[model samples]
Target: LALRSLAFQMSPQELDLGPEKVPGPVWGALFETHDAGAPFSLLVLHDGTAHLYLSTGGGLIGSHGLSEVSQASQRFMTQANRLHHQARPSQDHPLPAAGMSSFYFLTYQGVLCYTAPEARLGDGHDQLSPLFHLARGVVAALESAHHHQSRHTPPAR
Candidate 1:
């Protein structure tokens, strides 16, 4: 799972989402952190469909039901919608540079974007810090589920 091989999976367009396609209110968010040598992304939709693309390659795609992932996804969306107005309409889909983070909100009107230094977002110094924290929770829950599944499943022959 080389990082380059998974590059296509890390963008908003690859997820079948864009400003022109989505309509109405905020329905989902794509949060990306770029300071960690390689980019990492979390795409969380209103229906509890979450996909995490790691810098190490490969990724996780799941529909969370009554799990912790679902709860975290819900909370992330709530804050995303509440803060969407503060984001500007995105003219292009661009990945953040190192030491930065980007948040793209899919709304009925169109996609909106907010970008800031990773430290600012992670340290609760930005207004969107809560969303960043909630996204982390979703990532944690996804990782937990993956770990549990791996431990219980039989190895490939």
Candidate 2:
């Protein structure tokens, strides 16, 4: 649903899903043992700074943190280093607010996003990319899991 919503809102071509978005140290390869009571969800969004998760059957239950999550900072620095050489021609940008990696999650019909009004405001649409990225990633993961379960083949080994 999240991905669909994002897709509706913008084109996938504009979104970045490369390794930079979901780095190696983060989106684990482990099976991670299921809890078996109520299905849960976990993901790192916003260049991996924010951690998003939820565990509840109904009525909406979720949590998020703004810390670097180790992986995010590593990725951020790597990303910055890669882009440092590409100088902007004219437009100057104010630095974003001092804060850890921020993220937003949606649950039970509510959309939660983190925005620092005092922070750097780039293009009007920039603030929204994090939400769009998270939503799309989560939705795709969920759909893949569902497909794997339906097929009963262990999600392609």
Candidate 3:
């Protein structure tokens, strides 16, 4: 749904998410889509050091450093069945000693966003508030778009 909304409302331009220095045994993934005239991309990259970044072709927009935001985000995304994980070197850790996991969201205007929690396990939630709020707003926007679309579409024959 989020992807659909972005694809339908974003500009049709080339997105440049900048460069990444991913470490060995780790992989990065990028997802791109277009719909309703909107085009967007999501890039999840990790250096396999201690950082994971999310971007929309405009460089690093958000990141996670294995902190509380990471935990919370993981929990929420997992529950929502939107979290995608790669091979973990260990099962007990949220992230491997190297490598980073990717997450995605969007803005009200349909611009796509990527957020990866940083600051570590003990870090406060100040930075996370924006992410949470943005996600909430995006959800609302998606729902609203869905409702509007449903109302205008003709019934099946």
Candidate 4:
């Protein structure tokens, strides 16, 4: 499935179907970053399963499963829940322009979304800065874990 289509197609229940399961109401989030190269999307479930998709393939490219949710990821979810009121209910999941990022929250109610420039988010000038940074931190943790795993895995013949 196309990463952008996820906002319109994926449901919270579908996102909850992973190896790990969070015992509570199913919820999920999607973060899309548009840059000079292929757009990137990070889809995170309450279960701490994250799938990273690239526009080049229009499908899932990588997935990282967390044995336990990191503090930043948990905080990100909490902040997202609290800020849902600020996001407008969206049926159109528009792709942000280059250097911009779009965030989507999938709850029981429906899909909510907002977009902001990466610069503003990084500089803490955007209202969604807190959630943005927390998501970034989660991404960093995933990258670090992937790096560590690669180093330990034996090379294939």
Candidate 5:
């Protein structure tokens, strides 16, 4: 349903799914997007917690969550599990969020997989990916990361 809604809002082409390198159990993943200065973020915890946040230029608008057993949360788990099984994205060591925006995939083993320009969205254009329920702190961390990534990325020439 989330995927369908996203596909409807944008084109199906906007959605891309690939294998995770060194695939295994994931701790969680964060996705972010900005529109007209409004920052939106989705954080999915491995336990099936999904946190959704909408903030106004770094200010909080509202936060919502779906419980682990909820259908939405289950759907998110399914998606992450799919990535774990099929794509198995390479696990990279977590680096400082200093230079660029890289996709960070933290595994259950405490491994952090970092990929530059976060290939999950194809070619890092402005956009949002979908996920299930989680926590505010987690979401905030993700939003902060997104903001950091956005601020750090050198604008296209």
Candidate 6:
């Protein structure tokens, strides 16, 4: 595995997590009809960088090669199931932000990841390093873009 330090920051295109919109024939079926769209994911790629957005009331998923992904998903799902068991209706944190509740296990540039909810991950201001670390190639890619004399992508609002 290529170990690279994630540094530098550049604006990126926003991830369109509208629905189960993964591309390619093999990946298309990942989108099954969901009355409420409980378990789904969004895969966004720009240049050589990539990130995945999981949309599930209780989904914990990963795709780090099929075999490793399969192994990881079972453990992640087990944790999700445990959280489901302890769930109670309340206005406070309808979903947990980390460790449990709705989390995603993604391998960005081969780095195995378990992510907490985006909404509760706090603002991205203090998150550049961690975010780049999570998606190993992002910092380098973004930094390259930052150095370019051409148009740079705008940051998300």
Number of the top lDDT candidate: 1
Top model number, TM-score? 1
Prediction 1 global C-alpha lDDT: 0.75
lDDT (tens digit, per residue) of candidate 6 on 20-122: 4422111110111112334333222321123233343322222333333333333333333233222222222122323222222221111122334343333
Give per-residue CA lDDT, model 1, range 4-103, as digits (tens): 2243334435656454554426777888886359888888876566778776766786645637778778788888878888789986767788998888
TM-scores of all candidate predictions against the true structure: 0.80, 0.25, 0.27, 0.79, 0.36, 0.22
lDDT of 2 by residue, 43-124 (tens): 4333432222333422111122323243443343333333322222222212123431222222112223343332222223
Indicate the residue-level lDDT of 13 in model 5: 22
RMSD of 2: 16.6
| Model 5 misplaced regions, further than 4 Å | 1-24, 55-69, 84-103, 110-157
Clashing pairs in 6: none
Winner by lDDT between candidate 5 and candidate 2: 5
Model 3 Cα shift for residue 118 (angstroms): 16
Superposed Cα deviation of residue 92, candidate 1 (Å): 0.8
Task: Give the deviation of candidate 5 from the true structure as CA RMSD.
Answer: 16.0
Candidate 4 segments exceeding 4 Å error: 1-8, 14-26, 35-37, 58-71
Q: Against the correct fold, how does model 6 do in TM-score?
A: 0.22
Model 3 spans > 4 angstroms off: 1-125
Q: Estimate the overall C-alpha local distance difference test score of candidate 5.
A: 0.39
lDDT for each of the candidates?
A: 0.75, 0.31, 0.31, 0.69, 0.39, 0.26
Q: Which pairs of residues clash in candidate 4, taking residues 3 or more apart in a chain or in different chains?
A: none
lDDT tens readout by residue for model 4, 1-157: 3555745676655655442454333277888886456677777766556666667664433444554334546666777767766677888777667889888887676788888889999899988988888887767766766677789999999
Cα TM-score of candidate 2: 0.25
Positional deviation of 25 in candidate 3, in angstroms? 19
Query: Backbone clashes per model, in order?
Result: 2, 0, 10, 0, 14, 0
* Candidates ranked by TM-score: 1, 4, 5, 3, 2, 6
Q: Give per-residue CA lDDT, model 3, range 1-157, as digits (tens).
A: 3432333333322232122321221233233332233333333323211121222323222334524334443333322223222211221212112222223322122222233433321144533443333333333333444466579999999
Question: Residue 116 in candidate 3 has what lDDT?
Answer: 40
The predictions' CA RMSDs to the true structure, in order, are: 4.7, 16.6, 16.2, 3.8, 16.0, 16.8
